[model samples]
Target: MTQAAMPQVLIVDDDRAMRASLVALLEAAGWRVEAVSRASRVAETLVTFAADVILSDVRMPGMSGLDLLATLQEAFNPPVVLISAHGDIPMAVKAIQDGAYSFVEKPCEPRRLLTILRHAADQHRMRRDTASLRRRLTQISGLDRMLLGQTPGIADLREQVLDVADSDAAVLLVGETGTGKERVARALHDLGRNPAGPFLALNCATLQPAVFEAEFFGVEGGQVGKLLAAEGGTLFLDEIGACPLPVQSKLLRVIEDKQVTPLGATRPVPLSFRVVSATNEDPDAAQSDGRLRPDFLFRVNTFVLALPTLRQRRADLALLMTHFLEEFASVYETVVPELTQDDMAALLAHDWPGNVRELRNVAERRILSARRGGGSVAAAMHKDHELDDVPDTLREAVAAFERELIGKAIRAHAGRMDAVAEALGIGRRTLNEKIVKLGLDKGALL
Candidate 1:
């Protein structure tokens, strides 16, 4: 069945007549409707009914509809159209600012109210379908455990991970902060045959010098360190460059001997696990500076995987954006709104110094803020001049403009690549190539 025919609306009003009327009107209009009398039970009812739009009375006994709206705003972001008997323009304005979909008076025009509800419901369904499709695609793609990316740099890294996963050799992953180094390590562990064994991880930077030895080698009280905890699996040491020289020496000894000497213990414990370490610093420079031992570096550098920065793999930006959009939409219970060409342009023009993590934050903010304002995010972004500024060079300017326009079109059409291409008066293959050349994903723009 088509999405519009499947939308569900929740009617929250104390008056039985109003609730019945809303249910009848919505059902007759080809929408699924559920009627409820109490605001206190809205949350439970929402979960049970899986509402797409919430039509609620502003003032009610026990808990006011405004109170219910505020409470449900966080858990469920369905568009709420408020109805009030005693209209207060200021209160309605405040409600819109606080994320209400729209506000209407009690002596409401049936046609106008129904039209507004239909638009809101349609938008909600679109967002819900987008999110649902993303989740299903992620599962079907079978890349949930492996960080998904199609860039050449990421592909190379994945190949290296697979190669190293087959051996018992130690590996060192190097990358900037928030580059998913730990995720790479986990992927390595999973790819190996011994995945059933414990995969233990600890951040060396967070551990104090005094506890470093005890943490890595265990203690007299029979407490096992991360190394021992991974027995036959993998031990991941995050931020290994931050380890003190003294602690480094002890770790080096364990790597070489395949045994750890626990603190306050006379005997050494035999370890059979593999070691995988990650650092954001340059290992060669650190070794030359006496911060890291050259021998230790060689021991752990049996294999090395260096992750590229976000800008270096700009081709994956759109894919990452879509991934984050789906994630945030599910978490916030909001519809995934379409992006404008200008919004896409801004995203492409901005230098993402913080990488994927930063992009996720921006997408989340845009989605939530747009819903609260009762407007399309793309419309708001179009007003920003930064999206229109052309660069100095013709090639650079054209590329920048194309990226922005394409990005915006995809967003505007809710990531429908065909629709975006048609809107921009371009062929599908040409649009696909442009997206690739611009370092974006067609799906992401959608």
Candidate 2:
């Protein structure tokens, strides 16, 4: 089997001869190897190496293999194979109980060692993939907590996203510039089966055609292309309307056959990944204008999500503005500034051809307009721009008001929740409920 995407192995042994021998053997077998001297140094080396499986001798001078396994138990430890010169039935059983992958005795057969090590690497890949997928899912789930607003367009888009997130079919995201096509792609990926798999994206409009093939199919210089790197995951082609006609043919082949031949390689590399393409302009117009090929269009048009423009979701503007304010405030480390009515009207009146991205740029400018050194920047902020803090989603609006009320209550009652609830004239149950719902566990006062 080709070792292009094989798991990495780390070998640890105090013996210099043994370390050199193991390194040569693994390298000959088309495996990546990192050799370290002692058990204690494994953790520090792993910080940089990130081994899929560890092979170490049990009877080390300072720290034993069992000790190393115990130390790494709480962390995301890779599968470990412990080798020993004095290994017995009792020692082997003890090693297994201590989480060793296999306990091989000294003078181990090369074939047996290879078999056990490869199996250990396989287990490590599965565990690591699962953990990575879980993390991606959690991150996407948090981003969708409010999803900015409850407009019909937004609601429909969310439903559409869920309906098609699980499929491996090609997805064409059509939208106005800055309508968050990439965000939709990521949501689909996070919800897909291979959430932990690689996500490789290329901007078709930006790539130089002369260099596109080498970049896409990779060169002898070890510059792996998106197709190979994103195996078992998703490959996103951004600005698909600008894709070159020559590249278009090969892209279709890969999409249809799930395989790619590198620039300098003879044989084709097998690839299995979901294709998600996006274009800011109308795909039909592109095809008619000869910018996009008809067959290419048909192949990639398995599913399409037409993202709504900012104008179509004007009802979500106030809440979107609030989300941006909170987000930018956290980013720029500034006090959340106020927006006067004029600012609101200015924002609403504009056609916003550039969509939500344009509004985000305006929000950033609003935050930057306020005086940075002082605390009373909010009062000075609204004088220039007529913009005010307006929460977009129901969750966000409720959270904003809840934060203000609880903050005021805390200040009035000297940070005592019981006293604050009584002073606010609300029951303790209601106050606690609001606190928990608004994510106020570690509030400014408490």
Candidate 3:
């Protein structure tokens, strides 16, 4: 099994010797194990370990396992198993009632302990997977199609957006280019208190310094500003970091005073709308470099949501690729072509500097190219643009280079396995194994 597929356990106990013994026992049983002397550290360790089952002693220095159970109840935590020599019927009953998966007294049989842990871990994983499936179903059923992906980062972002959507606070979205900050901002508006109200968007970088206030505040009687236009709704400001200093001051005043004075009007107009701002640049850096005013940044950034880049969530690539491929194929009135293993390998190998937007474009290009009877998806991906030199890992870089070299060799040899193997100085069987391992489409090459 892969490292991610391995069952994981976290042991929390005050006794160092007991922790060591449990770690050894679990590791011997083909389970990944981590142990901590304090129950309090379990939460901190869990941030990275993601244990399927928490095997903790009943008593510890700072916090008892019972107390830990109480805290874990607040979040989506793994099943916890409490163990202690002092365990009794009353304590066991209390632990079970408090959401402990199972209770074991001191000197648990090796086989029994393993069996219980296995069951608990399996159940925890099943429940988590079920919840994730339900969440995806909800997304596809109209929660918001734009904020897609089942990766932990995206899932956490979805939860955060839902949590703050109804509130009328100003939110600042932070992410790299093409990470879909605008989509997130739109989701916030659509799910907010005034979905029926107008959702106005503005790009600060597109507005000249002289026209910024006029566009935001509007002329006296000529036209209404975006703030007024977005009454009872949301005003999304993209590239807020690029807002001019003068306009930032005025914007801050409007946000603070809850009103704005028209460019040629003396009277101030009352405004009621949430501000959802997005910036591809760093706010701190922008402020330091004088591109953004500190007061304006503080005013607009009531809450901040940071979006993850594509490389950070590669696990969701298959789902995202499928979604885009089918979507574009349907739009273009073409059959959904099956992506060969080589296509998948190429998709995974990309650095995706343009994030999800780049993936969507590539998928569309694949459908369009196939409509005109063009080459493979892998070939189409690199037809226009050179491969990004920076790979996320050495392994990925080497694998990608190997895939390219072998693909060229197969084309040169006309897909004759023996000829290709001879040209590459490897046995035919070994070459075939590499073809399968690297996910090359030999038939497509021919």
Candidates' lDDT values, in order?
Answer: 0.78, 0.79, 0.84
lDDT of candidate 2 over 1-446, digit per residue (tens): 55547768999899999999989988888789999888989989989887889998998899988889888785468888999888999989999998888999988999999999988887677556445544543455443643555589988988888899889888999999988888888888988889999888878777676776687788765788756888988889999999888888878888888887778888888889999999999999999999999999998889999999999999777667656765788897877665444455676777878788877776776675442322222332333344356767878877786786677667657778788788666899998888887777535675
Q: Write the per-residue lDDT of candidate 1 for residues 170-274, one digit (tens) a residue.
A: 999999887889888888888876989889897876767687777778788977776778889998888888877777777788888989888899998898888
* Tens-digit lDDT track of model 3 for 95-169: 999999999998999899999999888777755654554456455944446677878999899999999998999
Query: Among all windows of ten consecutive residues in candidate 2, which has the lowest summed lDDT?
Result: 371-380
TM-score of each: 0.53, 0.52, 0.56
Pairing residues by index, what is the TM-score of model 2? 0.52
- TM-score, candidate number 3: 0.56
Off by over 4 Å in 1: 1-140, 143-145, 370-446
Flag regions of model 3 displaced more than 4 Å.
1-139, 383-446
* Rank ordering of all candidates by TM-score, starting from the highest: 3, 1, 2
The C-alpha local distance difference test score for the whole of candidate 3 amounts to 0.84
Between prediction 1 and prediction 3, the one with superior lDDT is 3
Alpha-carbon RMSD of each model? 18.0, 24.8, 17.0
